[model samples]
Target: MFKEMKLLKPSWITALLVIVLSLLSIQNYRVLPAKEDIIFAAIHWHGPVLLTQTLLLCLIAWQVVSFRKIRFLVAIRGKDEVIQKNLLKLMTMEVIGYFILFDGSYLLTGHPIFSKGPVIIGILMLVLRMVLVWFLGLLLITTYTAPYPGLILLGVLVVNLFYHYVIEMNFLLIQYSQTYDPLWKAFNLNR
Candidate 1:
């Protein structure tokens, strides 16, 4: 019913991409948004709350979804732990770079993304977008590497449907941002 997989053995190119992107974070966003601004800054994509939730979910989903849906135990069944750890390191680096670039860009340039229509509905819609895009990424990556990736990709979608973490995290982000948005920034920080 199941076979061992070493799906996350990241290639040198992937590592290079992670390294390059992390280097970019060293630019623009040097530190947290000064002091009190950190609170208001929490709503933006770079905010700690949102990023933490997303990271935790991604980690959890990687194992939980794979185990339940794909029927394979990653990091446990074999020599997968080392590969998983390396992939995690690179992923973490990339995420940090993402935060720096987006937040710093906002601070230096202006708001990069926003809700197009209303507030709550638009936020949920954005959540849907994230969920779909993430699923697509999972599909594409799995398809490229593993010959029997359809079931794994389907597992990702099933997991998303069941846990709905994408919506939950985005909702929390919006609420936190709304709660902490400074008068000067207003809705600008709710990216």
Candidate 2:
């Protein structure tokens, strides 16, 4: 079963696409509302949240996919510790990035987390990412495998589509302004 599962590898392009979309969406959100308003309203909108969540999930998927490529136990000697350490590092980075980008700052963004729908969704995504990572690790360890790439890809597509619909419904599309938005300008701390 494990060997069968290892056949699947996530598409690097898709992962990169998710990250790019999420970052662009977040940039859009951060620029829309008045600069003086609370940052939460700007950052925690539906579209931005969905994009961030998708990006994090894609990162997690990539981590597991990479792990799946290596043989669980190599016949060659003395490579086990190095491989294990590297895997641990990758998992740690994914978990940390997921939390920081999706959860940690999110809680601080809105007025008292629960007061806003977007914040709630952000929290949910954060928890979901954590749970997903745990399950991915478990699958890697116990099954020495994961679901087929096709299944994972299908899931990603479904989630992406649902996210797109939600963003559209919320009218949270990323619209680039003709001029650089003040938020971006300020971030650059120029003019």
* Candidate no. 1 TM-score: 0.31
Query: What overall lDDT, based on C-alpha atoms, would model 1 receive against the true structure?
Result: 0.42
lDDT string for model 2 (29-69, tens) is 34544432222432334554455555555555555465554
Per-residue error for 124 in candidate 1, Å, reads 16
| Candidate maximizing TM-score | 2
CA lDDT, every prediction? 0.42, 0.45
**Cα deviation of 156, candidate 1, in Å:** 4.3
Query: Compared with the true structure, what per-residue lDDT tens digits does model 1 show for residues 116-182?
Result: 2235654454445444434434443443236565576566555644443444344544453454224
Model 2 stretches with alpha carbons more than 4 Å out: 1-25, 31-44, 48-50, 67-89, 102-147, 156-191
Q: What clash count goes with each model?
A: 0, 1
